[model samples]
Target chain A: MDNKVHLITEQDIHAYIDGELSGERKAAVEVFLAERDLPLERAARYLRNNFDLKAVRDEVYRDEKLKSEIDRLLARRKPRRHLIGASA
Target chain B: MTNQANTISTEDLNACLPALYRFAYTLTRNDDRASDLVQDCVERCLRKQHLFDGQNLRSWMFTVCRRVFLNQIRRDKVRGVAVDMEDAPQSKLSISAFQEEKMHYQDVVESFRELPHNDKVVLSLVAIEGLKYEEAAELLEVPVGTVRSRLSRARSRLRDLLENSGEEGTVVAASV
Candidate 1:
């Protein structure tokens, strides 16, 4: 809770939150983020807006036509997996 | 021999049309050309279905579509056709001014389009298609490091574009 601005860089914050940092580096980033003015909510927001792929997920799933088309194509290529009853 | 192969390949083409068309659109940025390119790829894929294995069908179709488009670009250099817009239908462009200004989404799309084809492909594979770097690397026949670098640059470029498009600090944070 020291009011001093955190020495940790934004990249450190990102890496720490994303579990990219490890051991002492991870602990140091956590402490620094806690001390800095950047709140937990802000940190969460930063990760979401910058790192999440939700936007693209929506984009890909938006058009029913596209999904159906892709599924159709994939179904066509599906190999006949013979599992049971070979002589049926 | 030909009939069974043709039927199977036609089904494959029908199923893969959306992804193929979208991939083509991503490459060319022009809907009609994308459609034509995808059609050409489907035809080629149908003809060559014997070469395809059942694994990674999406990746195979994407590879074929991309190669076909590039091939057309090569051929068009020698025998140019009229670039008419009336006959072929266009993509459903999400480029409304209000929408663009409101969310800067159109700005992002344009910035993506402005990037080099390789960059665009890398970005779309990661950002849009949600493929892991390894998967994307396999699809693009590039190293995983290459995909990561491309994605980093593409994300930085997108941020720059959004900032420049007068939508700084307005990025909607994901809730989940």
Candidate 2:
């Protein structure tokens, strides 16, 4: 060990895992975890959570009927131009 | 479509459909309502396309979806409907494999959907939507600190669920 004490908190770990840490802070966090032999499992778990969530959401989007309806809505003509173009 | 080049196009709307529907489903927790919310959100996005900065369409769409859901809840409240509760009838939230995918994915989805509403909201915004804490706070109208706490709690709960279901932590890690 280099005999250096680094202050790492719960929030720091989360931020680190979330990819929100700045370069310097992340390097510091890396050293802190390295000293303690941490495997960055938290980051992996969170990424897996995200991947799982994506897989689930993709399935939700697979409803072809619903997808068609949304596409139809998007294809509809824009609302009538204001009172200026009224032809009764 | 109007002559304004700034207007949201059919292509743009189509590209965002999946993400918008996913977020809408997260909000409503029901197929019909989620679809309605998404349609309503797209309609609003069309009408208000002029207001869009055209920088981040995904973020803008999410903001509008959140607003539309809240507005719908408010309208329900005015109509004497309880806006404070999830529609208990749909609480079961069946995730039957309507697709060719295996049953394992459905189980994972159910585990995700069974979390508390706030937990789901936090997770969807941060994990699924890929928004930063500040952006999620902007969307949720809460402080960044609140998003952080909810994220932490949501992830912890999700881990517990995965572990209980034998979702394979090391396997997930390797895949991710």
**Candidate whose DockQ is highest:** 2
Instruction: List model 1 lDDT by residue over B70-143, tens digit each.
Output: 46644542342212223123322223322322244345545545555555555555545545455566666678
TM-score of each: 0.34, 0.45
When candidate 1 is compared with the true two-chain complex, its DockQ is 0.03
Q: Candidate 2 at B19: error in angstroms? A: 36
What number of clashing residue pairs does each candidate have, in the order they appear? 3, 0
Worst 10 residues of 1 chain A by lDDT: A45-54
Q: Candidate 1 lDDT, tens digit per residue, A1-68?
A: 23444466555554443334565565556555433333433443333333223333444344455445
The candidate that wins on TM-score is: 2
| RMSD over all Cα atoms, model 2 | 18.7
Q: Report i-RMS for every model.
A: 15.8, 13.3
